[model samples]
Target chain A: DAGVTQSPTHLIKTRGQQVTLRCSPKSGHDTVSWYQQALGQGPQFIFQYYEEEERQRGNFPDRFSGHQFPNYSSELNVNALLLGDSALYLCASSSGGRREGHLNTEAFFGQGTRLTVV
Target chain B: QKEVEQDPGPLSVPEGAIVSLNCTYSNSAFQYFMWYRQYSRKGPELLMYTYSSGNKEDGRFTAQVDKSSKYISLFIRDSQPSDSATYLCAKKRNDYKLSFGAGTTVTVRA
Candidate 1:
């Protein structure tokens, strides 16, 4: 089966420009989450999408938002990017939603998109 | 203090050496512990996971958790150069979201 797949393996944009990163969850999975990882750091939770709505979000600002389609695919959008936004954007997928608490859900990740803001 | 703490070690070791990575968390509510390994310019891949206090072994990897001290450990046996990567310790607080450590980088020299 195909694992989580992310498009535009790499991207470049100006400070005032906006960018969108896309993700397709693994087969049989229903939830998708987004994360950002700066150099030499671990991935930080951005937000999670389920049922086409955002279920949980991290410490990110309003400038960062996402969407999930019925097919369990997801997109992350960052508006008015800053140089600090230059990092790796990662997408992870799990099988279910809220019930994930006690289920020992293991999230599968994509190769990630490298976004470079100039 | 951060929810989870880990050593960011660019630790270098000779081949076949045993490697030990550790992380400590301040929350007792964290019920699941996981270890992920990420190569350069790539996403992290789950390596091992454990729920309770004690040890879980899989192949050359062993995951140990100490709920009492809120500490977790991952041990690698017969380490190879290919084993070199960044290791992240993550904890789930009875919820789906994960809190990750700063990640420890390892390099196994041939």
Candidate 2:
């Protein structure tokens, strides 16, 4: 069985440009969450999608958005990218659609798409 | 202040030695704690997870959480060169989003 998979292992974009990164969640998983990991730092949550709707979001601005398809794949779109937006974008998949009680379900992550803004 | 604070240690240790890593969180409401390992140019992989204040051991890894102190720890026993990577500590409340600490990079020298 394949784990989480992300497209375009690496990307280069210019300021004010938009970039879209894709992800396919692990088999049997229904939820997808995106994270941004800057240099020398841990990943910061961007947002999470369930049932094709955003259920949770982080501190990111409106420029960062995401979509989840019925197939459980996800796409992260960053508009008007800034130099600071350059980082490794990670996609993680979990089994629960909506979490309740204790969250014991483990999340699996992909290798991540490296985005560099020049 | 950050929700979770971890020392970013480029810690170097000899192979076969025990490696210790720690992180502290500002929120007492964080109930789920986890430790993730990430290699260079790679995404983090979950290594250990615990919901309560105690130690959960799996092979060479042991995850410890102290709710009263709002601290978490991960210990690697008899580490190997392959263990060299950045270790991230993450915490989450009853909500869906996970808050992470700055990762600690470890290099196990042979």
Candidate 3:
């Protein structure tokens, strides 16, 4: 079975522009999550989508929004991108949402898209 | 202070050496601990996950958690050049919120 897949291995956008990154979950998985990793830093949680609804969110601003499709695929949209938004946008997937005894709930991540905002 | 603190090491070690990575968190509510490995320019892949204070081993990798001290560690045995990557330590608290530390980069040279 294929693991999580992300589109456009690399992307470049100018300041104030908008960019959309996509991700397809692993086979049999239904939850999708997004993260952002800055240079020399760990991936920071952006938000998580389950049942096509956002169940959790991080401290990101309103400019960062996302949608989860019925197929469990996801898209992260960032509007009015700033230089600070230049980072690797990572997409991860897990089977089911948070609950007891979740088998590792290990999120399989894709080879993130490197977003460069100039 | 950051909720989670980790040494951002560009640590270089010869092949066959054992590697130890660690992170500390200030929150006591953290119940789940995890470690992720990320190659250059790649997203992180989950390496190990453990709940509460204890030890969990998988092959050459071992994850240790000391909830009493709010510290966690990831140990790599028989480190190889292919093991070279940045290791991140993360904690999941309420609502499955994940807080990550600045990862430590390891370079295993043959």
Q: How many residue pairs clash in each candidate?
A: 0, 0, 0
Best by lDDT: 2
CAPRI-style docking class of model 1 based on DockQ = medium
**lDDT (Cα, tens digit) per residue for candidate 3, span A1-118:** 7799999899999999999999999998898989998888788899999988988899999999999999999999999999999999899898857463454278899999999998
Task: Give the per-residue lDDT of model 2 (tens digit) for A1-118.
Answer: 7899999999999999999999999999999999999989999999999899998999999999999999999999999999999999999999765546457388899999999999
Model-by-model lDDT, in order? Answer: 0.91, 0.92, 0.88
For candidate 3 chain B, the 10 contiguous residues with the lowest summed lDDT are B90-99
TM-score comparison, 1 vs 2, better candidate? 2
lDDT of 3 at A8: 86
Sort all candidates by lDDT, best to worst. Answer: 2, 1, 3
RMSD to true structure for each model, in Å:
1.1, 1.0, 1.6
Predicted candidate 2 versus true structure: per-residue lDDT over B4-76, tens digit per residue: 9998788999999999999999878746899999999988999988889989999999999988888899999
Q: Give me the runs in candidate 1 sitting further than 4 Å from their true place.
A: A98-100
Q: Please report, as a residue range, the 10-residue window in candidate 2 chain B with the lowest summed lDDT.
A: B25-34
Please report, as a residue range, the 10-residue window in candidate 1 chain B with the lowest summed lDDT. B90-99
**Residue A9 error for model 2, in Å?**
0.6
Worst 10 residues of 1 chain A by lDDT: A96-105
lDDT of 1 by residue, A30-116 (tens): 899999999888889999898999988999999999999989999999999999999999999998575756643788999999999
Residue pair clashes in candidate 1: none
TM-score of each: 0.97, 0.98, 0.95
Candidate 3 local lDDT, residue B104: 94
